[model samples]
Target: MTLGNWFALLVALVVAAEVVRALRHRAVRQERWRRFFRLRTTSWGLGILTFLLAVALAAPLLAPFDPNRQLDIVHLTNRPPSSTFLLGTDPLSRDVWSRLVYGTRVSLGIGALGALVAVALGDGLPFAALVVAIGLTSWFGTSRLVRAEVLSLRQRDFVVAARALGAGSSRVIVRHVLPNAAAPIIVSAALGVGNVLLLEAALSFLGIGVPPPDASWGNMIADGMPSIYTAPWSTFFPGLAISLVVMSLNGVADGVRDALDPREAP
Candidate 1:
């Protein structure tokens, strides 16, 4: 019923999922999927992400209190946490912890959801368009490089042998060309998450992101500006949460990239 209990349960579920995945990785015979599981770093990064998401999902129900509600002025205005207010009370006497918790859901939710929506929409026409542009620009930038590499690989004895063995051009391209050419693309895409979150935060901070009735960290800071000196926690807590989530995402993404790319080297 309480926030702590819900958070604990969520953690337990994630741990259980991880254990099951670990067991499956050990027990399953699928070599392809097994390779994925063997990448411990990816799993670790994903676990961090999943926990962040769980906190967001439970925000509405388990926030310390209604973020928008004005608290009783008699108790504590701009009060640091006491027996009554866990994290602290803001200028308006609203609970800083509760707003921060719920705002996590809003800010992260909008950032992530907006990014996914943009990506999803782009995956169709815009993506195809970008693919074309990417194909063109990439060819412009690295066509020479890709060609040199491909030509060198082609001259390799194994490639010659495969060609002599009747492997089609398609097979050669699929097996060789793509594996080498796709890495940059994946890396580029991975870099987009931070930019997307920043954009979302900017939008929210500008007051256009999520309308009121929603608790966004950016918007919270925006709302707190006028009273910030009087009650800095109102600004600090939400801003800190936003910064942490965005930084966490960046860290996780970098970890995954390093984990997956052995060529990055020890």
Candidate 2:
């Protein structure tokens, strides 16, 4: 009936789906995923990211009040943090905590979705037209990196042996070249998450993204500027959320890069 109830229902459904997926793939070892979080930095970043995502997902359950609901004018405006309102009220007398939680969903969702789609497509039309918007942008760098690696790899003794055994170009590339070249491409993708989030925030700030009624970090900051002197907390929390997410992503990326680098001794 309430917003929290709806969120609880959604969470239940998500859990159900995950259970079904796990059962369907029961043959697959879960260690593969666990290995990814083995590094201390990656574990910390993932822990933060997981917490944020949990907060966002359970926003309705956790927020003390609706993000957009204005409280009684006499008592709620620009109030400092207290038991009644943990993070204090915003300029509009809405719950700062609620808005921050919802805004997390908006900003992180857009950034992550955009980056993943763009990276997965590998410079396809949608990758350029919607996500990154370019002719040869991040794609160019990744392609060049892969090409150089492939070129060097193709000259290796293993590749020569494969070719000598009548392996087709496609077979050699797929079997030998790609497996070796995958590391850099993966590292680049991990780093790109931070870059994409920044771009999403910029777009939201400019009024072209994650429109009103739905809180996003960029829009919240934009909205708070006019009343910043009177209500600084309104802007501070969302900005902090953005900073944390980006920093966490970068930390995870760096950890993953180091862990995967061939030059690093085990």
Candidate 3:
């Protein structure tokens, strides 16, 4: 695998591990899971995200052709969807279906990386400067949300009890404050993935994203712009992918927020 593919695989593994760990937690299993699954939107969103993640993880095995391979510039370029090419060929004659499959890895990998950086550092960097820039621009809202949650939780009786028990600040913050503050952070991260994906696509469209020969939804859309009328599938498929992912993420975020809200009736 190429370095980018390796990095994407690593990120996917780390995310999967984290998810497994989270699922094994008592609170997540008993409370969060119960409430989260109560919402139909959450179920649908989770299903869609899971399918996309699976597609990304299985890209090498799933993609029919190399994303960067141009079959024939003269004859195959900008061809409409056919039995051979599922989505169609782009201006470069690369398989759109193949690129779309691979692009899932790029889009989700970068989105997950950016969200992690934003949560971990409040504002941070990534392997791609574009990812870093998206995280930096997006962290403030999450930071504010977390800061509010932390401040409110700090004044609670449990935090006071922990402080009285001589727990160190770091221990108290990690065990007491952050755990209670986790719901909003988790929701923010989920929502942030979609935002980061959109931002990355925008940057890529503007010629500063994933770079050529490597397929990204943004660059794919940009490449299709000139031939949009003749070959609308080129732009339509990628844009639809983006929209579906973002909408699914938003649904999940809203469900999570509702599920975690103390004010909500059980």
Candidate 4:
């Protein structure tokens, strides 16, 4: 019905599609999944990320007030958190909780979408140009790591045998080289999600992000700056969200790196 509703619907559809695809195709290995959960840091990271994503996906259902509608401007302006207002009212009298809930879409959507664009295109593209830019810039290390792995894998016995057995270059590379080289790429991707979020916050703080009436954590922080002395919660919650998300992502990346390392035992 509304833009936020549409965005929430889009997120739900994408998540459902991915789940269906994974179930139907068995995209990830059972052992790897088991191993992933066994890692304490990654498991915790997964839990944290899952909670944040759930909040984002359920924004329409969970948000109590309209994120955009200003209310009680006279009586409720900048009220502190109470049973009536979970997080409090912003200077505009908009529910901070609602904005934070909706803001989840802006922050995580940008991070996830930007990461996908970066990994898929490896260069600039239309539509998500800013995301692409961030992704492309962040992918250099991943590219180099992948390249080195590819070079090393090309000389492996399996690759040599695949070639000798009449396998095409493309098939050999895709089946053998790329699979072997996927560890660092996956780790880098995990780390890149966190980086993108941080960058988005920075850009939004500078007044160049999903603009007003549409709450992004960065812009929320910016909006609360003048009221820092009077209402600290407005800025505190969003900054805390950013910090936690980034830390969780980094933890996941580290766990994945350790998990996928040849030296580590499953």
Candidate of highest lDDT: 3
The residue-level lDDT of candidate 1 at 4 comes to: 75
Candidate 2 residue-wise lDDT, 1-266, digit = tens? 34564566466556545643453354245443334444666655665676677777777786767787888667778887766776777767887877887787766755665445424655344223435442224467667877888889878999999999999999998888876777677877766666666776776677765556567788787767777898888778888888888777876776666545545523
lDDT per residue for candidate 4 within 74-125, as digits (tens), equals 9988899987777888888888888998898778877876336333654324
* Clash pairs for candidate 3: none
Per-residue lDDT of model 3, residues 1-266, tens digit only: 24554565456556655653464453355765666666677666766787678778678865677999989999999988876887899988988988998888778877777335423553323235666677678889999998888889889998899889999999998887765676689889898888889988998888888767678888899988988999999999999999989988988887787666665535
Flag the better candidate by TM-score, 1 or 3.
3
Positional deviation of 168 in candidate 2, in angstroms?
2.4
Computed on alpha carbons, the lDDT of every model, listed in order, comes to 0.60, 0.68, 0.78, 0.75
Candidate 4 Cα misplacement greater than 4 A, ranges? 1-30, 114-129, 155-168, 262-266
Kindly provide the TM-score of model 2 when superposed on the true structure, using C-alpha atoms: 0.71
TM-scores for every predicted model: 0.61, 0.71, 0.76, 0.76
The 10-residue segment of model 3 with minimum total lDDT is 118-127
Ranking by lDDT: 3, 4, 2, 1
Off by over 4 Å in 1: 1-48, 73-76, 114-173, 262-266
What overall lDDT, based on C-alpha atoms, would model 3 receive against the true structure? 0.78
Give per-residue lDDT, candidate 3, residue 155: 90
**How well does candidate 4 match the true structure in TM-score terms?**
0.76
**Winner by lDDT between candidate 2 and candidate 1:** 2
Per-candidate Cα RMSD to the true structure, in Å, reads: 7.3, 6.6, 7.0, 6.6
